[model samples]
Target: MNNDFKNNAIRGPINAFMFKVLSGYMDRLFGKSKRQLFRNHPETVVEIGSGTGANMRYLKPGTTLIAIEPNIHMHANLKKSADKYGINLEIKAIKGELIDLADNSCDFVVSTLVLCTVKSPEQCVKQIKRILKPSGTFIFIEHVKAQKNSILRWIQNIMHKPWHWFFEGCHTNRDTKQVLELAGFSSLKLVSYNLYSPFIPIVSQIRGRAIK
Candidate 1:
């Protein structure tokens, strides 16, 4: 693991509790999208940068689920959470840019609130594409840069520096939608949107399926 992945969490108890609360909300929300995207069809679903397995419940047990999480600190929680559900969790301390999974092996690929912090977003998407089988859906729920009221962009840019420093690669202003297109993800169907993040005017909730 790298130094960035081994950094200690300085999050306060209150902050930690809030993180869990928000995460639980995402799990519950994504469940519907995940179910609708697959229509209850069981398939191999792999999630890149699965932080602490917070979204595990959204995945069906019959679906083959695998995860790649480079952060060692998050893996502890990932394991604990996986055990709680008796889920088959294959976690690795490997970067999303450097995933080591077989190409075209997964029926679907997933990501959640992860792209904002990954080092090589393009490479990660390319790797994800390679691993997904034909017509494999890439389910995701991420906060993206806003289009209206340049106010969001201004705020994001102003707070970007300290944000990245403290959060280890997080960029509040990452143009996630553009990046996804650049990575060749054209099959997109946005499901929802939100405007409240720790510090951002526009946060997006999206659903996209890769056209393999």
Candidate 2:
């Protein structure tokens, strides 16, 4: 527990409410496409910044799971989520972009709403790409700057400060979709979208198969 109060306390409730909103619309939000992402579950799934295990419900059984979270304060909750779901979750108290995992060792790497806060998301993306075995996939669900209306952009910019104060480093203006692509995601399957009061706003889930 690295004392990420930004997540455990302040952002925690926000995260809970956001998930509650999504839990209701999960089917329509994924619309069978999530199945595609899970079809070839890797032997081990390395998830970066797995906050309080909100993703537990989506995990398939028997897969080895490793979660990277720097916030010591929120570690327990993340562990609890895994236990509740019967997931074999491993915790890395350090950053995900610098996972101790050997190069090309993991079959899959994932991140969920976790990238926006990374001090260096690009480096983390590179590390994810580097650690994944050849042809491995990186699955992610993250909030990014909207591609649709500019009003959303304006709103994000305006509320960005309060959002960060409440949720640690969460930013409302990152363009995560483009980041993944630029970081070398050749194939992309966007899973869902929705507007916001929560910056969980219309996320773009990336399930990219490494071409190298």
lDDT at 202, model 2: 33
The C-alpha TM-scores of every prediction are: 0.81, 0.77
Clash counts for the predictions, in order = 0, 5
Error of 2 at 193 (Å): 4.3
Which lDDT tens digits does candidate 1 get at residues 1-212?
A: 23363344653233334445577665555566655665554556688876667766666664456878766556666777777766688876687877788887777777877777787677778888888777767766666765556776677777788776665567677777777777765476655466454445335445555565
Candidate number with greatest TM-score: 1
Candidate 1: Cα lDDT at 109: 76
Which residue pairs of candidate 2 clash? 1-72, 2-71, 2-72, 3-72, 194-202
Candidate 2 lDDT at 173 equals 79
TM-score of 2: 0.77
TM-score, cand. 1 vs. native: 0.81
Q: Give one digit per residue, the lDDT tens place, for model 2 in 130-204.
A: 888777778776777865566766777777888766665777778777777787665655644653333343342
Error of 1 at 99 (Å): 1.1
